[model samples]
Target: MGGRILVADSVATNRIALAAILKRGRYNVSMCSTASDALQMARAAPPDLVFSASELPDMPGTRLTERLKAQTGMRDVPVLLMSRDREAGDVVSALAAGAEDVMPQPFNELALMARTRSLMRARETDRALEQHQSTVRCLGFSEQAPDFAPAARIALVAESRARGIALAAQLKREISQPVATLDLTGALAEADSAAPPDVYVIDATLEAPGDGLRLLADLRSRPGTRHAAIVIITDADNSMAVANALDLGANDLLLVGFQPQELALRLKNQLARKRRADLLRASVEDSMRLAVIDPLTGLYNRRYAYAHIAQIDELARKTGRQYAVMLADIDRFKAINDTWGHAAGDAVLAEVAKRLRDNLRGIDMVARIGGEEFLMALPKTSDIDARMAAERLCALIARDPVRLPGSDQSTAVTISIGLAMSGAKGRLSLPVNTLIDKADRALYCAKAEGRNQVTVSRTAA
Candidate 1:
């Protein structure tokens, strides 16, 4: 099914007709006679979209939409209302009452289907984002509360400078953000700037044939502006141009002589959609950031360590040089937790992590593999250099005390390190786990001998 659609009309013929039209488009459709019945059917199983008659037998379609929107899960589903009678002020009232779109009588099938496809595309994108947000929340990560308003860029493009300026002036009265006019020749150059427009208003009736269409197609192909919202405005009755604009990825179509209020409302909707998309992109980036790093210690976690080690391993094999792997454990970490509380233990761990990171060369990587345990990797390194690096790490930690939160007192902590060297001569003779296991054993020996020291795996010798 392309999508699930519910049709609500009091007349049986209206219900059947709408359902047939949607069914032919391969939509999974359900029909209902009244607003009450529509609400019941929707609650039973939510649909992707709802089409309702403007006036129901018992209630208006606007009331039905309000009822559906009041439902917790159905708010995101679009509501489209149809009216055979184009009465004065009816469309505005229906729109104000929460209809996603109000289609008047004698609807052109082509235009109607185009609107349906556009709405479905937008809904599908939102659904995917909602599912991703749920998964991120399930992992116990919360989005940082945003404080700033969106400053979406709006660009007006036309072959005529005067016409572009006129459009910009009208947009300025409606949009709170910056609005700028660009010539057809300068559209791509402006798009390539540091801050590209979020929404584009292109005049389809440019003096040069297909000038606007070419720019629209190029914007869709460009990486920087591919996601932008494109609205096409035609000054004349060019049905072919309107259809072609829709086919060429125009988000909205407008008549050039339309009222500025109508254009403002449409622009507002486009900007809202753009802002939602931006937020979804940001959310995914943030989730990816959380996946690899430890929240408390601010260090790469175990998974990241293993993945990076594989990259380092490949480099070492190509270079035919020895690399070092070190496992470090803090001495008496549990005792520190028990005596000074977990706060002091956390402070000590964070401080030690900073010391380990700061003392290492840019070529080295350090990660927190377990509680009080850290793993370090150095690619294209020798055993002697590894030893000196480990010694320097130990001195950095033992030489200073960590400042505990909410207290003036400093807590003392020390770490032990176990290092193993890779095979020489451009050969990765041992697997990564083998090297880790060898270092683990040496770490055990260091802890047994006495904490706050370094030990080399016998296998390395």
Candidate 2:
């Protein structure tokens, strides 16, 4: 079975009809006669999605959807409203009230199942992102407030420039934002730009038949534009176009000519969705960063250092360039730890990290891989420049005294650097781990020769 589904309707025949269609698709279908029963059954064992008629004996499907969303755990479950032919206004209201979609009966099987699969796929994605729910909540991203009057970027693609301009002007009165009229030639290029549209409104009858649908596919193919909201506008009688558009990755659709107020409402809903997805993406990125970054010193951690070294090695191999690796260890770090508390030792580490990070080029990466030890990668650097950089870092640490947070005392510190380079000629065949090992060996050699100095590995020269 694809997923569990609950069908809620007042009439038995109506319930059975929808259930049979879902069952044909191998979904686990559960039937309920009233909205009250539907809620109880859903709370007992929540289904992946719900198909409820617009009117029930006790309540409307919109009310049922609202009730389900009220619960903390069931908020993500999708609800599709089934509206009779006479209920066009109700269908619009239901969608605005938060139903995933409203299908007018007799439902088009393709659109229904396509919508089902789409919603289910979204549900699964949300479920996966829930793994970071705790961290997202800690960052205050879990609770997002909707903007009352939405201002968003809109992309309008129509058959003619006049119709597109007219639509843009009509929309501009209701909401304040840039509504770009796009031709097919400039569509993909604009999508690649830094600020792509927030919502794309494309006319179904374009310069030629099916061009609008083709454009939707093109937009989704690009990584940067895939997440942008797409709304299709088509003629009233072309029911098949609506279905095709939905199945072809259009996020929302409207039939007939333009109405400004309804257009505003639909665009606002899309903007809200776009903002929410952006927030979730950002939260996941933050968690991923936290995993590989040292919270105290704000430097890359050991795990990131190892992976980064490999990436640099691959890039060097492809480009026929040399990369430098350096291991830095603070001299007599234990004495500082013993003389002052761990907090002062932490202060010293932070100071050293700042100096090393600020002095280097953007192409360099530095990580704290051990207690009082740091590792660095400098890509495409010559042996002389690498040695000069290592010596400069040593001097920066010894130049200043790191002050304690509370006490009026200061601690002086210096670092010893061990330098190794992937020989500029045969760097492609060299293993990154060997470079790291060579750097470690030279780091120890520097400590032996005396603390607070720099040493270069023999293999590097």
Candidate 3:
């Protein structure tokens, strides 16, 4: 994926080199020689990724990472630290300081490009999710709390049982999260589980060469584990495998074998990233549900009903099939609210919604379009069938009284329904709004003729 990257290095040659490589990969590259300049540039407009040398003129690269992360909009922008022959302690410190990874200098082109692609893809996804979440919050829904970090579940998969067990034990000691050891088959089985591992540490060459890469692809494809973070461990000499692992959706990689602390820190970062993604997905789902559903009666609202009617209309036009639309109103609903209070009216509305929803065919659509007013549609229905259905609905509501909130007493309730049909012989198809208006006129006829009855629209107009 193409993205903007900020490259900060004191050495002119190093900045040029990195920029050339990134530009070759189709990334827009910006450069700065000092940490202060990089900070200023980034604050003005955050890049998709940042590549900073561990040694900066004014401040250390890790400090730059810390500062960028502390910035409000820049927190999710990943930072990659370039280290030349850096010690293990330095790598650990950089990671702990929130750098995405510490890349070795005189970079391996294949590994560098693959890692860059991986980072860019993840950053793009994060940005899209954040944009959706922001839209949701703008619709008056609360955003998920950032500080909530649930305990992560980690899985250790190795070529051998002993190796897997040993690594699991080591990981258990380094982190407080639950750890489990699984072989290739066991890991595959996790794809069927409801709560699979939040992260999987897979040793390359499980049963044969590149087995772990296959597993990574499989886990990423499965719905249950598709969003789970995966880290692949490979030999330092196997740069091709490292590149392949990242290309196949491995979240991170471990070369020169795994150190418990380093793996733990990497796992922590992956877990936190996955949590943010999961919460954002949940928030989007909640917001979408709220947008289309009526909170009062737990039924679809006017907005959704209109869209659904359009769909039904289109389908009827294509298939030349008959469909029914009905406008239902609770008779004398205002008097109930005035006499017993809005609470009793709410109770009655809820009961009526439930009755309508339960009694209708599974393919039928029912929604509360307004207070004391509902919209129902039945596809592939005849006028005779529609009239019978409407009569049944009127009887269903008037058959028994609805019990009031927190009271033993009950009040009698009735509904008047107006029915209109599509696909009448020699008649042209009507627009959805026009059909609704016809149903409304029929409803007026029903209310005028009697309080509790069904009225079918006969005139084409």
Candidate topping TM-score: 3
Error of 3 at 330 (Å): 36
Residue 299 error for model 1, in Å?
Answer: 21
lDDT string for model 2 (306-372, tens) is: 8667767765675466889999999998999999989999999999999999999755888999799
TM-score of each: 0.59, 0.59, 0.64
lDDT of each: 0.79, 0.81, 0.86
- Writing each residue's lDDT as its tens digit, candidate 1 over 1-461 gives 56779899887887887777778888888998889989998897788899999999889888988899888779778888888875435654655566665765545656667667877877767765654455455555548637675688888887689977877787678667788888876789977888788989898856688888878888989888988999888743565676677777888776656555566666777777777777876774586477867777887788767766776676567546688999999999999999889988888888898888888875577889889999999876778889898888888889888888898888788889999988986457899999999999988998898878889999775
The deviation in Å at residue 277 for candidate 3 is 0.7
Candidate 3 residues lying further than 4 Å off, grouped into runs, are 143-149, 292-461
What is candidate 3's lDDT per residue for 1-461, written digit by digit as tens? 26679999999999999899889997879999999999899888678899999989899999999999998679999999998875778878989999988898989889999999999889867765665455456556645566857778899999899998888888888889999999999999977788899999999889998899999999999999999999999986778998999999999988755578899899999998999889888876676587967888888788767766776676567445678999999999999999999999999999999999999975687899989999999876788888999999999999999999899999999999988888563453677888888889999999999879988887522
- Model 1: weakest 10-residue lDDT segment is 131-140
- For residue 370, what is the lDDT in candidate 1? 84
- Best of the two (1, 3) by lDDT: 3
Off by over 4 Å in 1: 85-95, 235-240, 290-461
Top candidate (lDDT): 3
RMSD of each: 17.7, 16.9, 15.2
